[model samples]
Target chain A: MNRRKFLKQSSIISLGLLACPSLSSAFSLGANNDVIIGHNSHKYKVDLTWGNLNPLHTPVNDCHEMIQDSKGRIVLLTNHTKNNVIIYDKSGKLLETWGTDYPGAHGLTLVKENGEDFLLITDYERHQIIKTTIDGKVVFTIEYPAETGKYTTKDDFKPTETAVTENGDIYVTDGYGKQYILHYNHKGELLNFFGGSGTEDGQFLNAHGICYDNRNPQNPSLLVSARELNVLKRFDLQGNFIESFNVPGALICRPVIHKKDIYFAVLRSKSAINSDSGFILIMNENNEVVSCPGATSPSYQNNKLNELYQTVRLFQHPHDVCIDDDENMYVAQWNSGKTYPIKLTRV
Target chain B: MRKFIGIIIAMLVFSSCEKQQKEVTSFLQQGEIKLTNPRITVSNTLIDSFVTLKPEIHMEKLSVGYEENGKTPTEASTKLHTTISATKPGIYKFRAFHPDWKPSEVTSIKLYKKGHIPNKITWKTSANKKYKGQGETTLINNQKASLEFRDIEWVGFDTIAKATVSFNRKTYIKSLTISYLTDPKSWVFPPASVTLYLNDKDTINVTIPALTEKEIVKLDDIKIPIEKEISTIALKVNNVQKLPDWHAGKGLKAWLFMDEWIFN
Candidate 1:
């Protein structure tokens, strides 16, 4: 549990020892109402008040995604032009805010190079991927790959996410437009492109997210999220289709890896417009779903996973999740009435 | 009594040593906890033999109560712990119940028995190009679409959609039921009115009320009782020409979606 909850429970127990019989029952009830969510070994206590700020100054619209910098501070990205990036300490205190130019800031990724932190922000409206320092200074920008010959114009390339390998090779997923994975070098030169919109094993429908999986360290690959198809496809670094698996009933937004586990923020259950149908899914190193935070417990039969869906209305359109050093999760939402990120403290 | 007082003093001393965190209030509590509606699933609502409805709720300390005769389900209704076997066609309503939390809103579905199969069907006006599903055969195909308006079974019209059901011979029919999808969030609403022409002679007109606000996505069945036995029926369904000012699509025309037409 987080430090704040630990102190509160400690005080409550200390007071309960000397309180009257009637008051002790109320104390126990208050402790039980901590509102824990998730299942099995991945349960968490809900912290709804995390990262809340005054809307007049730090207003946010469509909290798209979040990540943790090397300084151990939580960074949030939103589409609202007023304050595109908001930094906060682990205890939910606002540290700083910047960037009024990113009107369509959708994806945020942090990469460390030479002991310095850099952020890769993907703006779908601008159709560009920008690299910036931790404090909001633009280092360089990568425009739409016109030389790839696959895209006719800049409007046909709407990049949603970018994954950087250890050697500085960048992989971008054009999720909203042509649904192709564009591979580029560190100098923003397009190398190869593949995976157009199709139902075949090599193609993708809505390749919403991409992540470089280095769990094995020797045989690293790229994991892409096919949101509409409810499948996760694995491809070798050279962009060859290795295999794919289904998470049946989930519209996963992205795959965030930490240690031996993979986490995802399911945008919705079945239909895109099905309001308040979002949840969080967790998978172990073996590529098996072990727990669903706001949904049903994971169960498999005959090597086929059961169709997973939301069981509680704790979240609405959870777009992304960021795991901190303490293993706590910060959830950013999309299209869910302008609200702040919610913190889930692992128990 | 003296020892109890001493113990209370020591407890206070130890509690004061611990640091107190800031008092932060979450805005989530503004919306009180309300149980989500239970999901009711069946293979097909258009049944020839019998249909089994499986009502599911995964939360603990919650029970699902349902009614089969179209009445609103309440806490005192029959607790549905297992699947419901229905041998006849009727409306089924369900709601989730908990002792501490607010009860969920009611969700209902309709089941229709096998009806007269039309030998031929034709539409006077075509549906919107984006949502035309297999032409006129979709109405008599007996396949019902889910709440999603994009389903292949739904044929949506932006204007008045008229269809004629004809049989090889004069077939006796008692009533006609029209199954349509309602998802107000997507600007899909029920038809404003329906006009039924029996054998191109007698006319039956029914006016549908507009929705006051957004509602859940569900397929609703509206039954038109016709006691007069008829062979050929001409059905006309009208779309909402202009949405209400309260709606986001205030001046735009709302879509009218139909999946099936059951003739009993």
Candidate 2:
């Protein structure tokens, strides 16, 4: 039978079993297999290893950011009403919950310098940047100063994500409220700010994500995710123009660097306004897409073909992604509305 | 025997007179013509220019008026200016119609001799004045509300310098007070301007420094007297000339930080 027929029959059987408590467990188990991977698929193998990190006792509203610290612990940042950051271990056990300070926390990063780890959080609601510790201690706070020449008035600025270099230089992307990257010195001093709101080669429409690449050590590059423009621009240490790369997907959230490889957690734009399934894309140093199993199929309108590829799985709004030192990937989803962090181990 | 008879006759007359007087007063009161229950119904019929499947509807009607005459009576209208009054307390149907549109769903209101006062307005902010950093500030009045940005970075036009205010909800927001800290040396344009969006639509645009106090444009939409509620206010700066930096000809190291928002 076709996939639709199979799904229909399975749904009927599951609905009928819902009335029987004992049969419910069996039905749930069968439902897990309902995710059918078609032949000749490029999607990666994703295992729902662990979950259940709901702190407010409500379903997770929006998992906008996620990262892994040096200790291999996964930290998930959500845009829920309270308890924005939820920490979990590799085994999916809830370790701790923090970040009641930020209501609309959108982006999160764990900056490791020397031997200390600093948690950098971006507040989309308040339009400020905050640096704290893993235990939710506020180390430093940086509000938008009155010295940036980019804003004409005081009401047009909202910062979404930030990137910090090894030398303590910080670059923050004002994605929502304003379109400029405000640069600050290591001491939280406004050194200078560059880039304006535009659709030009160097300018950005929505500078949603950012990262500092210190691979060369001598000259670190600032990789900015110009989300609306669908391109990532690389800037030199002095904020000079360098290069750009096109991201395959539309809604690219965050780019995580694991060793030399860059993994982008991309949400495929649904044909309809709010369709949610998306997947992850891994790219190597050469910018070539590293095909993996369980990646979701590129969906299109009026197309009934089920392109169940290995590299593309059924991911509903993949917001942020992080990889451990071992190249294991963790993705936080948005529309899924669950606080559980998804894990993808490289086979 | 004469005295006893006289006492019984007097008691009966007094009792009969009292009963007749009560009947006459009751008849007069019932005959007085008055709009017993006057009510008004308001609704937001469209959302995003489309007919909302579930339109928001509210009704206000009660007994709080006096009889003008035995046939003519008047009632106080609701704040919306649309009202209906009944000659007597009973189940009344109200329906509103928009030109070139289908009639709204009929609503039945039961008028009584009692009325309820409007709900008291309560306001709250996700991040108040004492709270620093970025978060949503909500002002709630009844079911209608609005949201304002607190401590958010404002960038556009030229560049925002510094903004400060203390929001007081003593009355509904009659006007949004914005204070700017711009350097005269960095004033590229003599008149710096900004626009405020209520819901993605431009509602107000005003220039800074109010040189004559009348230079500021009091927006019409803003005159509706913002209800005690939370509304999402989007501020955008426009027509600003990029000023040169004082240190060098390069762009100035200027930023805009909103310290507070005052809705008065």
Compute the interface RMSD for each candidate structure: 6.8, 35.6
RMSD list, candidates in order: 5.7, 26.2
**TM-scores, each model vs. reference:** 0.85, 0.48
| Predicted complex 2: CAPRI docking category | incorrect
Docking class of 1: acceptable
User: Model 1, B206-245: lDDT tens per residue?
Assistant: 9988877564676776789987767788999999999988
Find the 10 residues in a row with the least total lDDT in model 1 chain A.
Answer: A20-29
Model 1 alpha-carbon miss at residue B34, Å = 3.3
For residue A207, model 2's alpha carbon misses the true position, in angstroms, by 0.7
Q: How does chain B score by TM in each prediction?
A: 0.82, 0.25
Off by over 4 Å in 1: A1-26, A271-273, B1-32, B43-50, B57-61, B69-72, B87-90, B98-102, B122-138, B141-143, B148-162, B167-174, B184-195, B203-215, B225-227, B238-256
Q: Across residues B150-201, which tens digit of lDDT does each residue of candidate 2 receive?
A: 1132111234322222223333445553322222322222225555555344
By DockQ, the best candidate is 1
